[model samples]
Target: MNTALDPTGATAAYLAKLPKGAVETAAHYTQGSHWVLVIGKLAAVVACLIILRSGILPRIAAMTGSRNRQNFAVFATGFAALLLQALLLMPWTFYADLVRERSYGLSNLTTGAWLTQSFITAVAGALVGGLLFIPLYVIIRRAKQRWWMWSSALLALLIALATVFAPYAAGLFNRYEPLQPGVVHDVVTDLARQASLSGEEIVIYDGSKQTDRYTASVTGVGGTARIALSDTVMRDPVDIPAIRAVVAHEIGHYKHHHLLILAGAVALLSCIGLIMAAFAFPTALRLLGGGGVGGISDASGIPVLLAISAVFTLVTTPVVNTVMRLVERDADAYGLNLAREPDGAARALLATTSYRAPSPSRLEEVIFYDHPSIESRLRVAMEWKAAAQGR
Candidate 1:
């Protein structure tokens, strides 16, 4: 079964089709984001520090002055702290999300659209914070020493809810319609059948209104599950193979229960983080708490807890990313086997270079990438093709 086909050579020839300098330009944009990630974390810490030292939240909480108002106070102070952090990070957010994306020709948003989206996101985040943190504070007050365990359970529930309801939630922002009858639709339906997924779950969303990049995902569980493709991906009839390849990859995620796995992993990490934070809370309270902060249950202590959580997440990023990348690699292999369209998979992976760096050094990928580099994925696809042809 030995084949003379050189997968590496084939992959190189495929990549050589890219416009000169495309890879370098995309790489520069992505590499710069590593700095942005570091700066953003620092800014969040500084923002929390300001809130801790300012005594603003404690003053607001004190204004509640009634046992009945404690829950409301939690929401109010947590919402305020979140808003303040967002405000502090706004400059960096604007630069990184909009200006930088526009410079790289990746963003399709106008300033007005960006502002509208940002405002909507901010409002939604504040609402969710109010809903989440109020109950969180209640847990802290009642559970006391065991709050970390209870809080982790609550976090796990929220993660499950978020994952299951993601498609419906996304519809609030983007218009989704069932894909029309066509070659792409036919291919997607066939793939869905092979994967034993509901054909009714295939949808197309108007993502071109936001970005020109191709995107697709399978999300939710039970009745809420959907396989959604961005309109950009299906705009051209010739893109059928790429669309098939992407959808197959998404189907692989569903078959492997990657969403559930990721959700569980995040919840587990959060529990670990809370455990660590519980141990570290007292030291942080002493060093950063000042006169405004009282203790873990106090409104002012929220920022300190937040700062601790952010630090923990930053520290665990590489490990988290490595796990995610491995999952993605597994899915890629599954997709190749299921779809038997390695060339199409290779093409789809290459198309992602419109925004993603086609290749990053091993160290760069290890630290920053949650998906395998395109070069690696393409090589694997090529190898799959050669093996299939030989067989």
Candidate 2:
């Protein structure tokens, strides 16, 4: 397996020639899309509240005479509202996921394929939300004041279950196959062995079917643990050594058990968010012209709960992003040490600059970037190279 670094500085020169304007244009689109999503979500929540307040939800509930039927009515109402919100957000989605990607030359998907995938995602989200909210409403109905605590526990369990089952869920979106035997395969397998992983744990997936972005991930835990590489990584423009370095970084994540650590952090935050929501929900509902704690389980209360949850998420974004960046830095360091290929790491970082800003401002990095910016990562790799050469 060839693990050689680029000897002539050619890769660095090529990366330097990559258009800064392209990066800026993509960033502008991305930032605008984020604000659009936030505003659209709030608008959707307001619409749901209005519909509920105008006697629509109550009339729908009245259509069902029995208690069980009424509960189903609540679920149906919330699900329909979520689907409506999704429809309202479709223009933003098209611009961000389809048009912007095409403009950046990063997407391979046709409009039909994009629409089909979007529909699938929306339906999946509605199903998941309905499953959770049914029990959530029951908890609110029965537990009253302590409902938040119980609901948080349920959320944590569901998150944990989702983490364990992620590989299966991911298969619904993309196709995976064993990587063909070759130099790339050999390098990946060797890295896997160094990371104490077996051959069966590595596979390549058809990521290029949707996007030109390069990505790899270690998904699931225990027997389900597997490392998946995007087909884009094995194609031209990304060299063999850089691909090896990327695999090493993913193995670092697996070796460090970052997935479980992240899951735990999210579970803890969910608990905190739920506690905050419990205190905030009654006041928020009153502000929305809805009844107080007595109506917590009402279909009208769903939007209030969601709106507060969104606020909690927005307020906590920095904390969550900080933790994620730290974990990513740890993986970068681990991969650098294990791969012993700083140039390869630098080249891999450069590949991402096609979509990510090469050198984001500190505030932008802190608030929006979950991974280290390309400049920061390349600097780290260069620093390591200097230290290693001195030794």
Candidate 3:
């Protein structure tokens, strides 16, 4: 796409329909349907928790014979809740995040394209995370004694698996591309792999699919190297400096080990959840009804797990995002050095992220925004450029 001002006149206007207010407003109340879909997942985390805490089965168990039965009641209830949550949220998340992007000018996908992408994402998440849950549940049941250690160890395995899963799925869906040489290819390569980011094609998607915005990224780790730019980017009259600056910032993510760091954080999180679930979940066997190692006892321990997991989520999300912001700062700084130009980057920042208050409250950025606001990045870019030029 031509981010250069369209000399073709009307081409610029037609492509420039992304309204700042609309985007800003939509950014407010917020949404998504596919739940754990489109890579902006919530299915495994949110919905699973809800179903357990719903108390449907808990009420049933509480009224039954085993008033002290925590294990069976919680386990059964939690498993059912998690499954139900996935069934309900995955479709919604798929629609809201991916579909809406295409629908509201944020995505440039045809209905078929959108469906294909959403379906792929859903299948991948379910196959990797959803399917694993069932066996994980069963395993906890069988190894009730050493649940935490086994669970933690299992968590580590799952985390390792989860990290590799996306890259494989990306290839399965024909999403992988060898990074080709471009103006910034060498720089991206240097950033991704210190000694061997070579032959890696910078896989970028047409991000302009749903909105007239300029955004780019280095997503995934190791072999799953992907870089995406919205269609809004090419059509817009953004100066090259900002484009390069942004690209460089994305490269910074690779260069500064952001992927490795993010992967580590995620691994820790999943490990904790798994280990906790392993120990915490097994305890429920003593709650409702259980057959010990064999038969059916009372089957009502699932809800307890749900309630615990839900409480953990609200606390963990904020922490994860904070870590994300810290890493983003590092990438932004790196981008400044690589781009070697700040003015164009600043201008591009303005045009692309007009919806984002150049200066958001600290809390807003922490809780709501993922990437640093354009102002924040541009600020660092200009500051660095100014110092380099002795201005």
Candidate 4:
């Protein structure tokens, strides 16, 4: 990994000194956390299946008393399984999200606050999963052999719906307000105008309430679309040009409709994964002594389905991450042209190295990063500057 410090710029200099070992430590922590969560959740699913095979889930279903209670059983089973996974993974979550972030000086969240947030996240996930379980179970029972096809369609619809409501959903966790009149606000609005985005879409959010990360994003779809900057960006010693470059990058995402494309790609992947799961689930279940579980509809089959889906996702990670990296690189190019501040763009890229490695191996970048490495991004910025100067 290229860890060379930029020799000429204040922003780059500050970024260079941002707590050594953070990049490698963060990468190890992140990769370890991902595998730990995956293994822990898979184990929990197996444990839940064992409990189901022991007739606990059936007993729980019996309590609903025969008013077409299969739907109730499915929801209850899925929720219980999810809760088990959460419980099993809670220690990892705390260590990865709260402890590691604090150790790296990235997070400002107190333990209580972090716990509250975790609880909210867990409850929210359970609620959404339970609600979706009803329809999913219906499709499984009704479609029989074709359940995966319908489920894939349902997944796509859900992705679309989530995209539409994501901005509102995000507001539940963080506070947002308009960018107050200032140079940052002026630069942001100017970029919005240049990108044909509405000034109303530009806002500032209290991101520093949770993390010290300086960042921005273009989120939501249609009327919900928003350009938001973290309070860290507003207050951090980053120059106006760097801030503008960041905003321009976000605008590039919006201008290029990257969100729509991303959602579509994810939806397509969901379909492919579900199609694979359709073929894999029954065989896996039969081998696991779960043939007694009635087709895909049986609440007991949830673990097998989950396991298959997880494997499918794991296998496809490289393809999906590659697509995301390409999209991000396109946005970088657009931002460079729009902002006309390659140096600022390079500085902004460096600023994020507190957590992200300034350089990563090509294979590592392809497999793990959804965005281009800082080295790649800075190189693009420098090349753009060189070309522009030659002109």
Best of the candidates, lDDT: 1
Off by over 4 Å in 3: 1-84, 90-95, 98-104, 110-116, 134-145, 164-197, 210-213, 219-232, 236-238, 274-311, 351-357
Q: Write the per-residue lDDT of candidate 3 for residues 1-391, one digit (tens) a residue.
A: 4233322232223224446675564444232221222233334444544544455655644654574544444444444445465566657655665565555555555667666766665555544443455455555667765555566666676666565444444444334344456544555455456423444456554444444567666655544546554444445353556666677777778666776677688778766875565555545433422323122222444434544465455457767777888898887677666666566566666664433544567776676566676556755665565467554
Q: How much RMSD separates candidate 1 from the native structure? A: 2.0
Instruction: Give TM per candidate.
Output: 0.94, 0.88, 0.64, 0.88
lDDT of 1 by residue, 1-391 (tens): 4647799999999899888688888888888988888888877888888888888888888787897889888988888888787777788889989998899888888999888888777778877886799888899999999999999999999987776566577776689998888788889888878777763477899898878887799875664458889989966556777777888888888878887788888888989999998899888777775566777888768888878888888888888898889889888988888788888888888888877788788999999988999989999999998888887
lDDT-superior candidate, 3 or 4:
4
What 10-residue stretch in candidate 1 is worst by lDDT? 218-227
Candidate 1 TM-score versus the reference: 0.94
- Looking at model 4, residue 315 earns an lDDT score of 69
Mind sharing the TM-score for model 2? 0.88
Ranking by TM-score: 1, 2, 4, 3
Residue 25 Cα positional deviation in candidate 3, in Å, after optimal superposition: 3.7
lDDT of 4 by residue, 101-155 (tens): 7877878999998898888888788767877888988987789888888888899
Per-model root-mean-square deviation over C-alphas: 2.0, 4.0, 8.9, 4.3
